[model samples]
Each structure stands twice: as structure tokens, then as C-alpha cells.
Target: MPVSQQRPLTFFGVAFAFLATMLGTTLPTPLYPLYQTQFGFSQLIITVIFAAYAVGVIAALLVTGRWSDQLGRRPILLGGLFAAMISDAVFLQADGLGAMLAGRVLSGLSAGVFTGTATVAVMELAPSYLKRHAALAATAANMGGLGLGPVVAGLCSRYLPDPLWLPYLLHLGLAGLAMLAIWQAPETVTRPERIRLRLQRLSVPTEVRAVFVPAAIAGFAGFSVLGFFTATAPAFMGRIMDVSNLLAIGVVAGLPFFASTVGQLAQERVPLSYRLPLGCVILLLGVVAIGAGIALASLTWFVCGAVVAGIGQGIAFRAGLGEVVAASPLTRRAEVTSSFFVVAYVAISLPVVGIGVTARLIGLQATGEIFAALVALLVLMALVLLRRQRRPVMP
Candidate 1:
């Protein structure tokens, strides 16, 4: 128990659990084409299936987001891993569209539970010397796991024996291991003997609204870019550009998330006041590049844009989150953090779903270009709002 309670070990252990859960969520990303092919569904159904994940996430955040503050961190973390395990099992046994939808929603629930809980848990568990660096560690695990899922799943499906079954099989094994590892980690929250569970009603304190609003706005726009890459980019590669190799598609599509992970390294050195606005500027450039790529049918431009936008998203994500978390009261930290993610995941779901629908009407290429343009416009708006402030947003 004493060994299990060691700060670094517990910190890393929970972070690994966070990574493992997220990895499962994205495992289906590169494989979506296969599922469409196997299930004989249209592209619209694919996007809807992906959007279902956000619905589940929003629901979980609204319902159980605060439970971690009431219950201990370890149990909530374990619950999320268990949900991921079930999601993997659903995918393993999936036979039709309904099953696929179910799996995605379950995957979203797992992610929703972990995103805020694990972020705070790892930060809380970090030793004093590493406190400032803990946010990078936590956020990197998230983006890193997201980046790895497609590559790992793509590889297993491409080279390994079974395409659909093998990736989930490997993840299931990892989830099991993650559960055991997390069980040994110490709980960061002090638990009450009589714990009462209630739904989390989302609210930002009057004082935090200033920082929270701008941060959420940046997150919403940046995450919309990520949503496009995660949900529609693969289809664009295969259908529009004629890139058919699952490995190539996965590698290309996963580039933004990988870039975001790298961006976190640099954000650690950036000043708190400068991070959000600077990130917004970079994100705008990246989205515009992506728009041009779609208009010109150039994959290189798309990839370039992805890297740029990812870096901006990473910087904004860490900066916004650091400011919000630091400002939140100790009792409500998880709730506010969960609320921030609610906005981020909403960006992930709704805009991409709109793209999916719009693609059916106007076509994928045009829809992607329009989406990029709109995201760039949104970023500009956020920057304008940030510029209007007389006092610096962050202290």
C-alpha cells in the first residue's frame, strides 16, 4: 500500500489509465471506412455514429462530472476504464449499425468520465517539484493516446491477421492491465463515509466567468478543427484524394493530435497571458491552410494545416485549462473542468455532424472548406473579444 501510494508512481499510473481509456476511443477512427464497407452504410451514418460519442460525453459530464469530488478519484477512474472495456467488447462483437452506435456512445462515456477526473487526479498526485509541469503531463497523455490509437489500430488491421477484431482485442488486454494499475494508485480526493451522488449542474462562479468564457471560446474553436480531422479527414483522404491504404490514412489523419502533444511541450514555457491569444492566431492560420488544401485538392496543404492548428490547439488547451483550474475553488475544480470539456466535446460533435450532413448536400470537399473558413472566422472573433479587455486576463 505504501509503495502504491508513492506520488510519482500514482501520478503516472493514473495518467496511464487516462491514456488507455482515450486510446480505446480513437481505435475505431482509422477503421471507420472498414466498418462502413462491412456494414454497408453511407458517409452520413458514419458521421452520425461519430457524433453519438459527443452526446454520451455531454450526458456523462452533466450527470456524473462532480462525482469524483464526492467519491475518491480511484473509483471514478476505475469506472471509466470499465466503461472502456465494455466499449471494446461491444466493438469486438459488433454485427451492425446499432452495435456500432452503442460502442461509440460507450466510448464517449468512458472519455467523459476520465477527461476531467484524470486531469485533476494526475495534477493532484504530482510531487511538489513537478507541480507546474503536471498539466503538460496530463494533457499530453490525452492527446498522445488520441494520436496513438489510429496508428496502432491501423497497424494491427493492416499487418495482423484480423482487421476488425484484432485492434479491439489488443486494447481490451491493455484496458485490463490499466484497471489493475489504477487500482494500486492512491485516491487524491478525501472520501466522505456517507457519499451522496447527484447530477452536476454546470455553472461558473462569477469571478471565474472572465477567464472561463475566453478559454471555453478558444477551446470550442480549436476542438472544432480536431473534430473535423478525427471524423471527416479519413473520408476526405479515401474519397477525395484517393489515398486508400489504411495505414497511410491513419498516419496522415492522426498527425494533428500528435502535433498537439508536441505543442504542449512548448506551451509550458509560454506566459499565461500570451498563450490563449497567440494560440488563437496560430489556429487561424492552420485552419486557413486546411481550407486551401480542400479547395485545391492538395493533401500536403491539409497535412501542413493540421500540424499548425494542432500546435495552436495544444497551447490554447493548456493555457485555458491552467487558468481555469487555478482559479476554481478546491471543492468545485472537477465540475468546472468537466464543464470546460463539455464545451470542447460539443465542438467535437456538432460542427462535424453539421459537416457530415452538409457533405451529403454540398459534397465533402466543399463542406470541409466551408468548415475551415467558419472555424477561422470563429477564431478571429475570439481574438477580437480577447483584445477588448483592458486588464490582462490571467494573473
Candidate 2:
């Protein structure tokens, strides 16, 4: 069949595949408390578990970032879905920290592969008329799946037959569906006659450096806030605010991700040069709100902060991504995008570990305040750097 005939069914199919893989990455967010209770671990353990996934992502990215550009998008993405399913099965059988950590690492591998490969695949599959909007659609699917995971998991854990097992089972089913859908979707990359495996290198080209630098910093800061919420916000809700409902915690945890989608949408109205700085400004404000929430012990303040941070992160994230994609050499696009995400996953993992360490020492409230302050500092730095860029990235 002609590519045009396959555009609608194929494009959306790959998008859904992207979403399903991302959903698996965060499926364990709300379930952390359950793991803590059962395993009797520390706050640091939570960060470590989450970080394990990020580490897996970085590892896969280092190995397979450009695989789609060589072996084609379809096969790499199929490998990603298979990884996700394996992670779910691992989670289903998890008995202690080791198994859970292993599961998360596998999940990370899945996300790492998908993050670059799937994003590019969705855009490649878009019909000509929808081309301009395809990038946003891909990003929305990424953030939306991430945001929705905890919510769906929360609900299942709260009311389902077995809290621990049911969510993974449900996701396992979704993974199966996504795989079937993607199997039918057309491959966008032309397969080379000779396929050789090469590790992804981690350097930015000279031209992309200006945007890459600020974008990585902004991405780091925005993702730091997101990491905190996903890893430990439930602890705050349960301990600081006295909320015990799993559903509520999941919903709150997901707010930033969903808000990020909104931010991405709003960036369409922003000028090419102003988007990153504006996003940093919004992110800094959100950090303040989060600090306020921590100081006052107000759930309302915390929720407000999350929404603001999400929006800021979304705007900055998309802006940085757009600039990088635009600036990259055509053949090396996926590789460069992978390098960017390596920074992001690093940001998501390390800072949250710091939160765990600080929370353990000074307690959650003071620790949260300090985290907010640190994030704000990074955002300001990014804003300054963005202002100093010599050449504007042209789309």
C-alpha cells in the first residue's frame, strides 16, 4: 500500500504504541508506598528504584539511540514493547527490592529506546497535512502516557482484586494491544542492505550546542521537579498533609505531566526565541509555589505548584526539543535527540536521589523547600544562558 493510504492508521497506531510504552515506565509510581510498606525500605530506596529505571534508559540510549535510523523504527520499537512487557511480568512476580529494581531497569530500557525512536516514528508517519502538528502530538502522547500511568495504577490498586498485581496485569494487556497495533503500522525508515550495530555517541555538534546547552539545563530543572513529584510526593501527601487515598495521590502525582502538555500547547503562541525563557520563568514560579506548599503544609499549594511546573516544563521541554530537531543534521537526528534525553533522564534520577538524602536528614518539609529553591536556581541559570544565545534556532 502507498504511504499516503497508510498515514492515518499507521501514524496514530505508532503514537498509541509510544503512549503504551511510556505508561509502563511510570506504572509503579503510586505503588512505591506499597513497596515501601511491604519491603520496609527507606526514602533513599524509593529514589534508587526510580533511578534504576533512568539508568536503564541511559544505558539503552547509549546502545540503541540510532538503531531506528539504521535498522528501521519498526523493529526497534517492537523490541521496546517487548521490554515493557517483560518488565510488567517482572513486577508481577516481584518479592523484594532486587526484583523490583530489576523490573524498573527493564522498564527504563523500554522507555529509553522508545523516547527517541518512537518520537521520530510518529512524526515520520504523519500525513502531510498534519506535519506541523505532529511533533506536539508525539510529545503529548509521551507526557500523557506518563501522567496517566500513575492515575490508572492508583485506581486499580485502590479498588481492584489485588493492588500489587492487577495494575501490571492491566498494563500487560495494554502492551499486547499496542504491539498488535504497531505490528500493522508501516515502517518509516528504509532498511539498509548492510545493518551493523553501533553504540550511540554522546557529543553535540557545534551548531546545535547553543540550543542544546540551555535546553539540557532547562530540561534538567523541569524534570527535577517532575522527578520529585513522581518519586516522593505521595510521601508528603500521606505524612505532611494526612491524605491516605491512593487515588488522590496518583492524581496529584500526574498533575505536572498533564500540565506539561498544556504548556506545550501554549508555546505555539510564543515566538521562537522567547519560549525557553518564558518556560523557565514559569518553572521558577512553580518552584516557589511548591516551596510555599512545603512551608505551609498546604495540599492546595502543592497541587498549584505541580500544575505550574508541568506547564513550564512542557514549554521548555518542547522548545528545546524543537530547536534540537531543527538544528541537527538530518541523518544524525535520532542520535542527537537521544543525547538530549540522556541529560533529561540523568536530571530525573540524580536530583530525586538528593531529595531522598536530604529528606532523610532534615525531614520531608525542609527537604522539599530546599529542592524547590535548587530547581529555581537552575531555571534562572537556563534563562540567562538562553538570553545569551548568539543565533536563534530556526525551525
Clashes per model (N, Cα, C within 3 A)? 0, 0
Residue 307 lDDT in model 2?
Answer: 99
Tens digits of per-residue lDDT for model 2 on 1-395? 88689788888888998998898898888888888899998888989999898999999899988788888888899999999999999999999889989999999999988988898888988999999989888988899999999999999988887889999999999899899878998877788899888998777888888778989999999988888888888888888888888989999999999999999999989998788888989999999999999889999999999999999999999899888889999977867887888889899999989988988889988888888888899998888887777556789
TM-score of 1: 0.93
Q: How far off is residue 22 in model 2, in Å? A: 0.7
For model 2, which pairs clash?
Answer: none
lDDT of 1 by residue, 125-208 (tens): 888888988987897789888888888888987898888999999999889988987888777788788888998867788888
In model 2, what lDDT does residue 67 have?
80
Cα RMSD of all models vs. native, in order, equals 2.7, 2.8
Query: Against the hidden true structure, what lDDT does model 2 obtain?
Result: 0.89
Model 2 — TM-score against the truth? 0.94
What TM-score goes with each of the models? 0.93, 0.94
Off by over 4 Å in 2: 1-4, 206-208, 325-335, 390-395
